[model samples]
Target: MQSNHKKRICIVTRSLSEGGADRVASLQSILLNNLGYQVFIVTILNSVSYPYKGELFNLGAIKEKNDTILGRFNRLLLLRKFLKSKKIDIVVDHRVRKKPFSEYIISALVYPKKTIYVVHNHAIDLYFPPFKWLTKLVYKKSKAIVSVSGKIQNLIFKKYGFRHLETIYNPVDLDYIDKQKIESVTIESPYVFWYGRFEDEQKNLSLLVDSYNDSKLKSQGVKLVLMGNGKDKDKILSKVGELGLTDTIVVLPFSSNPFPYIFNSKFTVLSSRFEGFPMTVLESLACGIPVVSVRYDNYEDGVLKHKHNGVLVENHNSGALAKGLNLLVGDEKLYLSCCENARKSIESFSMEAIALQWKNLIEK
Candidate 1:
């Protein structure tokens, strides 16, 4: 590809804050730029710093004056005009189109020659009823539909009747993850680390916490480390306090870099009820850390294999999660095997490899 003749690619999203989709957008922009593509990121809300090392253009913030009838129409008008003026070759929209109403508006107004919609959630229940008609119309108009996992693609096809969707697993930048020379942090006893937001319901933190509290692992000094802040932090903290796990559990906020913790920890745990291929699993594997995840449709097949890279527990089962954690932390040989396998498993999903995938797809 000629450097100067590089295609102008724009990624449009609601925001660039901490999330898997946002991170993917940033990484794609950086990788595409390195491959000699002129990239621009347009945000409809919140000005988030471009997390990728590439050229980023913010197309002004979304101005919502009030909840008046004219106000809504004016905002849509502004967005439509902005889309027309950009004259970009491709526009990739990354946002949930739950209701057909909004999808209809976006399809009718912001018409691009090649518009791609990337779906990152599997909640089919939310895409029906009030906006059923609009939803079908928008999907029909979409040039390409991208899902983060095969599970999501299947859900879209089976429930929503969209068969043309493509599955692209989230990519990790192994190059940026700093692997520390320090040997794993020596804990006097084995510890089970859960490094993510404290939202007990969605993240299923309570399941892990209750399981650990009632397991033999607790008697053996298996500690739970909770990282990342959220709306439910206070409730989680209170629950921990009530359970008298203040000494056994630790809660921390989000980190700009979470690799050091991943490196020091023995193993990572993901307890999400649902996911669109989480980047955290990829990040943990890149750092040579094993993971124990709730068996989700996509993640089980993609990341957590029986004993290969990580362990997959039955979904929403505290006992299963606890058992998986105990096995990894208690059995030294199994832990080592899992760590080694995790490191090897992530080779194909590295940034360079994924960039080539994106390049081939875009150029096609």
Candidate 2:
């Protein structure tokens, strides 16, 4: 029999915005709640208005005025007080500090016995001074450190000399995906689809656009479909126009649910320069869609096995990405084979299996 006392699991993040960490935290909360745990979400911002089916209680909201130095200190004090009063069983901290020094300070002050710090990125090279020291301190203080990718885990472990880091690949709700029947939308034209933000530097969108325009695939009916909004959208769109790809390329705003388009597209493409286990790739595979990605991280290796499950391109090379896309689109048998393999690869990442993993972690 399950214990009557609900395990109070508190998830602390910066906000419930439409980012990968926010999505992961939300999914975790839903799964934990289904497992009979009382899930509390603590955030510093208050822009979230999306209806969450799971039971989630928000702590006192902090205004944007608290974004300054003293404001951050006050927020930390408020968090500490809240933790003390709530008597949370397990506190999962997912805050990626804007300033590295604050990481150490925050870790030192928030001394919850059962605290888990989740590392979501591998690009810690940009971390500011005192931040490195703070990160090390937090790593030492954390009861457990969870990395979204093995690459991230190895990087952090090597940097901080922490030996017991755990790698948990971001999970996808496969059941929800399976329920989404492939829509009967006609492919008006054969095209390669890229459904993520136009963050050129991070997503390597510029490289993707240049490569696609240069490729022989462009002569064929293979246009590039760009989706998702970001700070760099206008710049990226202007570049697309400059390349005379305005007709060949389609730019879309961000969607709360991108599955419908994913289901109807020829395949999914990821042009990221770096990723800590991309949620888009997992979500695409769960929808039984083939993917073409630039291999920059170890997690990409797990998802796209060259031409087996999906195509893997050389990092920062637009030519290789374009060639890979062309090969997949040209070969009908290969396209079907890759999509089938992608669906199978995502079986382990199903919600039930991931939820079981979470349950084991928390119960242990």
Please report the candidate that would top lDDT against the real structure.
2
- lDDT, candidate 1, equals 0.71
lDDT by residue (65-92, candidate 1, tens digit) is 3546676566667667766676567777
Residue 206 CA error for candidate 2 (Å)?
0.6
Q: Looking at model 1, how many pairs of residues clash?
A: 2
lDDT agreement of model 2 with the native: 0.73
Which portions of model 1 show Cα errors greater than 4 Å?
1-5, 47-50, 53-75, 124-130, 179-191, 197-199
TM-score of 1: 0.86
For 189-226, candidate 2 gives per-residue lDDT tens digits of 57767766567778888888887886766687777787
